[model samples]
Target: MLIAQLSDPHLRPKGVLYHGIVDSNAMFAAAIEHLNGLSPQPDLVLVSGDIVDEGAPAEYEFARELLSAIRQPLLVIPGNHDEREAFRRSFADFDTTSRSGPLHFAAGDFGPVRILGVDVTVPGLHHGDFDDDAAAWLEQQLAAAPGRPTIVMMHQPPFACGIPYVDEYWCRNGERLAALIARFPNVERIACGHVHRFMQLRFGGTLLCTAPSTTTAIALRFQADAEPASYLEPPAFLLHHWKEDAGLVTHLVPIGRFPGPFDFA
Candidate 1:
């Protein structure tokens, strides 16, 4: 099974640009076209978070309309920039039981892979956490299906990615999350967003990967004093392929046009 993951699109209202630079809406449209044109289309598409820039009703409406064009089944979670109420109302069809409380946490089976989506976003905060309620709920989901290949999805990455500016907002109580995941050997990987760049690390015996935003990318800075910044680096998304015997493998697919497919002469 092939699962495509797009993160942090940060779509804005019509004619609005993110940060007065990137055209998030246009970038997202291009990404949708690319995904639709894939030779072997993805069975499922997961939009990790940051569906809009300002978390406004109009912004969510715009994003919902754009995302409706995707052919594959799409799953979404909330990010720091997302407003829970507006986001819930926008994607209400995805989870009907999510009318109240944290926007739905559940396990879904897609072929051989089981997807566990958890809500870690804290309203009006730039950071995230898996509090007591979320932790207990996640544990229940993991226990329900043991030894099944599973992918955990959330907005904030639990581990630090070395960019001090971004690390400052890393998921709090991450240690608790790691501990819970350690007990579940079936957890193949933890997919995340918010960093706006591709990042990977091993934690709790599972791979933790952050997908790049389709709009723009965050600069890679190792210096502690480096200010928050973004760049025009080619945006991209992740394609995770699962095989019965080979397990899961991920490929980074860049957006936009480039010369390629020339046969070696």
Candidate 2:
């Protein structure tokens, strides 16, 4: 199965700009065009979160209009920038999207891989949570499919990414969640997106990767007091391909029209 992952489009209302600078909607449109241009195409597209800049209804409305261009199926979760009620109302027609409460869901019909999405956003906060209830719910889902190869998707990364500014709002109480995941050997990957950068880390007896945003790349800084900022670095996304013989491999693809593919004899 081939899966394409897109994160943090950060869409704004029509004729508006992201952070009053970048043309986020147009950038998102380019991402959609990029996805549609993939060879063999993807069996499914998984959106990690932050589909809009604000939790506003208008933002979701614009998000919906932009998202309609994806030819493949999609499963989306919410990020800190997404408002729950507005998100639910906007994407109510999607599969397994929670109609109320936290937007947690599990689906097994997408292909050989089973997808489990855990929403950790705390109503109005910049961080995420993995409390006992959330862990229990995850445990239940994992227990029900112990033999299935699974990909766990969430908005906030459970571990710190060394970027002090971004780490300030990471998922809280993540150790408990990690402990539980350690026992689930069928889990192939823990995919997350929130920091708007490409990163990979070892965690929970599996690989956890955070995809780059389809819009802006967050400034990469490790200094304790590094100023927070985002750049117009080339946009990027992730693709995870899985097969029975080769396990799973994830690729980072930068979105743009670069140079040519010369023949290498």
Cα lDDT of candidate 1 equals 0.89
lDDT of 2 by residue, 10-78 (tens): 999999999999999999999999889999899999999999988888888888888889988889999
Error of 2 at 165 (Å): 0.7
Q: Which clashing pairs does model 1 show?
A: none
Off by over 4 Å in 1: none
Given candidate 2, what's the lDDT at residue 184?
96
Please report the candidate that would top TM-score against the real structure: 2
Q: Which ten residues in a row have the lowest lDDT in candidate 2?
A: 256-265
Cα lDDT of model 1 by residue, 1-265, tens digit: 9999999999999999998888999999999999998989999999998999889998998998899899988888889999998988888888523887776466465678888888898999989898998899889989998888999999999888889999989888999999999999999989999999988899888999999999888889989899988898898999999999889998999987789779985
Q: For every candidate structure, what is the RMSD over all alpha carbons to the true structure, in angstroms?
A: 1.3, 0.9
Q: List the residue pairs that clash in candidate 2.
A: none
